[model samples]
Target chain A: MTISQAGSYPSSKGIKISTVDTKEVLCGTALIKRGFAHMQKHGVIMDVTNVEQAQIAEDAGAVAVMVLDKLPYDVRHAGGVARTASVKVIQSILDSVSIPIMAKCRIGHSSEASILEEIGVDMVDESEVLSPADENRHIWKWNYTTPFVNGAKNLGEALRRIEEGAAMIRTKGEPGTGDVSQAVAHIRMVNNEIKKIKGIYDNNDDQELIRISREIQSSFEIVKETGKLGRLPVVNFAAGGISTPADAALLMKLGCDGIFVGSGIFKAEDPLERAKAVVIATTYFDDPKTVLEAQKMIDEKKSMLGLDTKNLDLKMQERGPTI
Target chain B: MNNELLIGVLGLQGDIEENIKATTNALKEMNLKGKVLSVRYPEEIMKIDGLIIPGGESTVMGLLIAIKNGLLDAITKILQEGLPVMGTCAGMIVLAKKSYDKIVGNKRQLLLGVLDIEVERNSFGRQYDSFESKLNISGIGNDYKGIFIRAPTVISVGPQVEILSKFDEKIVAVKQENIIGTSFHPELSGDYRMHRLFIQLVTNWKDANKGHQNF
Candidate 1:
């Protein structure tokens, strides 16, 4: 909430301002977005975008949780479109927690966001790429008040999103897998391309989005070589293959605002316990005291969704969630 | 007694302060007196001259609003009272009489749906999908630098609603009597003219209210 002359708070990557009079509570590392209420006053952001996991994350000190479009167990089983399966799962997560819930719409699923609006999730992340028609065809971020935190592979893509209106940025982890290479590439790209812009993107330019993405793609090699996140286009967070607190900590060292633990928690041995531990790792990335304390709290509880819920379940996933 | 005029900012979610800054600055420029306050309490609706709903994530705000003190009922009352409300981006969605689909529709979509329009959330795309344009506002005269970030698009407008601006034939701005809705961020552009126009609405309301009070 500390706005400068431009009416925005400065971030390592971009401006962090709030519409609510409520301050960002960043004096020390309080988290935000994944069931934010329980966050242990660490400014280190801990954003849990998955709903079933959000409940556990919220209980375990997540500053905020994101309510994303979940890959339905049924849809995964039946092999259909990533159909909206656990719509109510997200709603239940939102209903249960006071922290922000980030609702995601896959690339080109703008209509899906409308349902999220009705469901009342907090933020959004358009994670998946559009179908060839949308991605190859290209679709831009629309205007929204929910400060959007987008994923970029490099500085240019980050800038493109910022230039187009992204308030925050994260390195795009080549989704649907645990590949950290894409995440690494994104960091390199952002660090290399940091010096190229002044203001965030606020226009609808096709060339700009692609150009930025290219920069991000190119810098992946450089970032890997340097082993550092150079300069993010906005407040940078890391995603893709982050499962453990130690993994979360490594990305933070690599320069991320937070880490999006996608399949990490829900797929963990103990979701609730690991959710707490991840929250600790995200905010206390640099602080050993907090990290150790969070580690002690880890109680390895079996994650609810079994192997049957794992990917390649086209039928069960298509069957959708009864919840 | 002179009825005090007030402006309400949809404190539901998002940038309530930005609108407060612009609106307060513009009102000051117009030689008018008002207060910019955070409206977690819906009862504040009764004391304002007008309402300004700032831009932010509408989904979060719409969902969280019910839990924020007594804001829900206050918004419902203000709209029913015919209080002038202006919405920008996410604010526009909150002000619409209907929207594409929302999260908690069963408990009733927490929309104060007062305006005669259907607003689609994130219609413009994601943050990376965002774009800016030189929007030619109908009544505001000058082409304001429109800042649309994760903005919405008006899918359908009620007959009473007037389409104010468009980009590539997409409806981005609209107006209906006292309610002014747009898909872009005007305050972000440092333009006080729109605030002035809204103030004019407040002033006119003051004048009309004065006449009614006397009678």
Candidate 2:
């Protein structure tokens, strides 16, 4: 009963204490923000434009709702400078749902992020779904307490975003395409790169490891950690072009920590049923029967007609920092 | 035979992995034989000697546990049966008997209601107001760094609940029998002292109950 009793278990592990005195706990450490992201694992984050849509998302079992001024597809067609949702719109959705509300801020738009933080949004997305505010720079995320989720297409992109203090990372698949192929391609690229890093680490190729870290524009420490863990040090979700339960399930199976559905739910005829189905699919992604059951919840003909990613003019995936 | 303690972290939502890592590190540091598992179902509750409810969005976590998974009753039963449980942040809110969101007003939701205390959600205001400070916990070692992230504040406690720690004269931690609740996230603090204390409590509880029943 008391831990004083001697046992056969190994006691060789020595205790290590962190010597660094943390003067400021800062909004949340990368680890703490990553911890928050972990809470959303196995859950769905739906994008909503209004209070009603927010309620539908919540009622459909969405763990969180991303507040947006326009759906990604609408933004694509309207062709204007996309920015953070207005404070009034965000406040209305915040008032409507008990679940956490996340809002999108344009890439490198720290001012927009600050405003969203000021208005009390739970999380901010340095979203590729919105127009790039700055071509060469990203929001120095460490300056804010609200965690930021950024999009990445490959390991280097993912690592660069993490280096920039992104608490969460998602694949920058072509949004509004209703196509899962690009998302699949991005995730696979990241995964393959991770596997290669792990192989190099296993082979004890320190020189190659350093080279990869440089190529990725990330710290060697984080790069090595990712190699050892065989996954991104932070939570990675799949986003863009995910329009169905099956699409969500596919990404989840492909090793995403979670799935983000923008323009997928509300754009559908039955947002309620589609959202709920996507949530179920995410929760039971590995089980084909469960995914099939979830898939049965929707009417494909009534779903939003998705564009092919190949024909898209603006490539949001290629918009961020190139490292 | 080795008496290895098994700790379960509620994995339904919130900082599940971080708590697991912290607990694992704590067990190693204390030279305790234990394994930490992330518990997602009602049945997993029976397999562990202690539990941790991590910080996360309380409403979503509550909805999943109390409604979607129907584990609230099961959790309450275990707490009454003397399961040593520690809840941090939103976890603390979930364990309390009464809780209110300061920004959202007096709308109360379903909680575990095990700890007899009142909690005001986001007592430190918004994410912008979050801060970290070293404080003296009543029983733990001195200068424990507490990480407050949109943290809740313990406004009141029942006669039986003991105040463990405070920040800026605000209630931040409390203990009632085998249950422990902290408004700030100890798991995120990179310190294992709190978890070590919980493990010690679990060991003592196990020792006391050895002859009474098998856990």
Candidate 3:
């Protein structure tokens, strides 16, 4: 029977398929959430704490704003439990900006995710930058209708998140460092792993593919899909240590679909100009001349004093599961 | 064999890729040859036979159009020149003569003012209130899934505008001249009927305007 004629069939918990056209099922399908995430491609998602900051981000051309209780660097320095932002703050940010607003919940904090979803936040980031509420489990994201983004340092970690129903993935770079080294390293590692998997898929090594899937703890279908695509099934953005326009452009050049600025924007000496510059750089990432022009938009000394990732006492990137 | 049509999706912001994919799929299903490109620069808009404005943040999109050098003027000129354009969700908001967000108070956004209609942004309440329902578009067949996510609703239409579809008795889709606006997202609905309709509109326009100096 055709998909349209097949009648209704039980699928995933939230999703329902009419079996009529298997490819055309609409309601809670991965396509809808992925399509939402794809909307933010080649754009910047800035972290904003208040209505004013959200306004600044929108004016500076941020495609979306991440509602945070404190900047990532501040979270790192405070050394306390960094949970999700209060409903009040999120509501204010939502009211202040017409652009999409994303909020961060502590890893494994599904309650916080539900709250944000209830309040109508566009997306939620199960961010590692926030203190982990549960070490053994990340949010079981498929249970919610709102799309989610999670961080990963390698292909296996990325696949695991996708398996958990993450609609978007970003490198869990050492956030708030201002040094892009960790972000770069994570992105390269994931890309290299994808290349290796592609090689296995090209050889039609089903057993090896199964072995890899078992090792990664991700489903075989998703792992094989990743191998075939030579990349994560979802949009891969670079997050964490992005500070300067040059840094943002560098990540885009390294094949990230987008960049997320956390402590980078508001912590800089000139946030307004810095934010605009980073956006311009991201948009014209392939043009060296335009990147240079964007680079000139801000002063080096005025940028947030970047921390050396190697010297950091805590590495948020290492917080998430490896396999 | 230079008879290929180029369709452009406004790439300034929003759900651009999905629209591109949907349009491409629509073209393929129709057995038509067409190239889909994301239009960022103003000059790029001049080369397309048709245009699509995908859903996103209407206020931000308007700000970008206002700031982008010559983009607003370019779009206005093209619309006046009878370029076939489809605006979905926030895109529909951008094409309206007037738009208001009740939650944001009395402030009205600067829009293309090309389509003579008034739009209420986020008329469907919050994001959680978003839902999908089968719609019977005037031209397209019934049971076309229409996805509404923080969608706008057309409150009023001008004499020239033709209402295509409605949900809950609210105007959700319309057409005026070469422009079409839908408060729901066709790209996300996994149905390419609306996109197919737009493609057909583009092809017809191309045929009628063949060899015309200003396309």
Which residue pairs clash within candidate 3?
A3-A19, A3-A20, A3-A21, A4-A20, A4-A21
Best by TM-score: 3
Tens digit per residue, CA lDDT, model 2, B1-215: 23778888987556777888889999999998888998766777766788898877676667667543546766877788887999988888988899887776665466888899999987877655566667779888668878777789999999999999877778998999988999887887778898888888899877776511224
Model with the higher DockQ, candidate 1 or 2 = 2
**Clash counts for the predictions, in order:** 97, 0, 5
- DockQ, per-model, please? 0.02, 0.24, 0.30
Lowest lDDT 10-residue stretch of candidate 1 chain A: A25-34
Is model 3 an incorrect, acceptable, medium or high docking prediction?
acceptable
Q: How accurate is candidate 1 locally (lDDT)?
A: 0.55
User: For model 1, how does the per-residue alpha-carbon lDDT over A1-323 read when each residue is reduced to its tens digit?
Assistant: 21211112234222234221221212101112211111112222333445556656655545456554442222233343553326767767765554446666654455664566456554556554212113431124333334455666655455455444444566665543433555666675555455332122233343554454454543332222222222432356776555567666777777665667666566556767777677656545776765666666654344323332133322211121111
Which stretches in model 1 have alpha-carbon errors above 4 Å?
A1-46, A49-323, B1-5, B101-108, B211-215
Q: Residues B79-134, candidate 1: write the lDDT tens digits.
A: 67666778887688878877753322322345777888877665644333344446
Best by lDDT: 3
What is the lDDT for B32 in model 2? 87
For B167-195, candidate 3 gives per-residue lDDT tens digits of 77789999998899999888877678899
Tell me model 2's lDDT, rounded to 2 decimals.
0.80
